[model samples]
Target: MIYVTGERVQAYQVRSAFFDTRWRGLDPAQVHDYLCRVADEMDRLHRELTTARTESERVRQALRQWQSRHNGCRRRGHDD
Candidate 1:
């Protein structure tokens, strides 16, 4: 029985492939395939992280702008 965790699944899968290759003396073609798959996964994860960070920053900026406006409105009421 194999239990997998989300964070380690990709690493585990790659390691498992390498271990199998070593045991069976797999050819270069199979090794290349595994490496390519790992690279593609890394690229996808990178893009996702970048997109999430960008969205978070935009939200933060918007919140700051709204807070500034709200403060200004409150000050105006106090002056009147």
Candidate 2:
């Protein structure tokens, strides 16, 4: 019962979708292929997101350390 709203759609949502069959309905094989591709792309994007978040956290920590050091130096009257 996963509906694709305007917001973000997860891979599982895409996989769980089913189309009702009737006269002159859309091809099922094509739908399956497209869904597979979309799911694969979503998985790849998830991995990239995880990597980017980790990198961002590392950079944030590094910047905080640098700022702390700089502030300590200024408090000691050391200009650099």
Candidate 3:
């Protein structure tokens, strides 16, 4: 239910979004179907986010190792 400008939107929020019940309101079945689709998309986004985070961490670790190994390459006139 967090609807701030830049806040993260989770699947539950998408699935449980409140419908405007002041008048006839939305069709329940159609709303459920659409929410399910949107929730599925949110799940996919979360999976992609996890994958990106893992890959970013792996690349950062590799870069740290490379930097440690090549801390003084130019100063020693050695190119590898």
Candidate 4:
């Protein structure tokens, strides 16, 4: 059983309207172009979020590794 978060649901609702012909009205071509732009922006945001998450994970891993190494050295009485 999967649960959809409120933010995810809202985002889907916003994107769904872009595809609804009734809401899009007579200017189909214009609507298509506008939606394409929105899609591009969304893609850009996703890439940025991916990069940020990867960087954060790397920093967390590095901090853990450093702490473990420091602890090991301290245990061995290597006080400097």
lDDT on C-alpha atoms for all candidate structures: 0.70, 0.88, 0.88, 0.69
lDDT of 2 by residue, 5-76 (tens): 787888987877788888998899899889989998999999999999999999999999999889988888
TM-score of 2: 0.82
Residue 59, candidate 1: how far off, in angstroms? 0.4
Per-residue C-alpha lDDT of model 3 across residues 45-69, encoded as one tens digit per residue: 9999999999999999999999989
Worst 10 residues of 3 by lDDT: 17-26
Model 1 CA RMSD to the hidden true structure, in angstroms: 5.7
| TM-score ranking of the models | 2, 3, 4, 1
| Better lDDT candidate (1, 4) | 1
RMSD of each: 5.7, 2.2, 2.1, 5.5
lDDT of 1: 0.70
lDDT of 1 by residue, 1-80 (tens): 25566654454345455434466586878776777788678768978988999999999999998887787777678531
- The top-ranked prediction according to TM-score is 2
Candidate 4 displacement at residue 41 in angstroms = 0.7
Q: Give the poorly placed runs of model 2, Cα more than 4 Å off.
A: 4-8
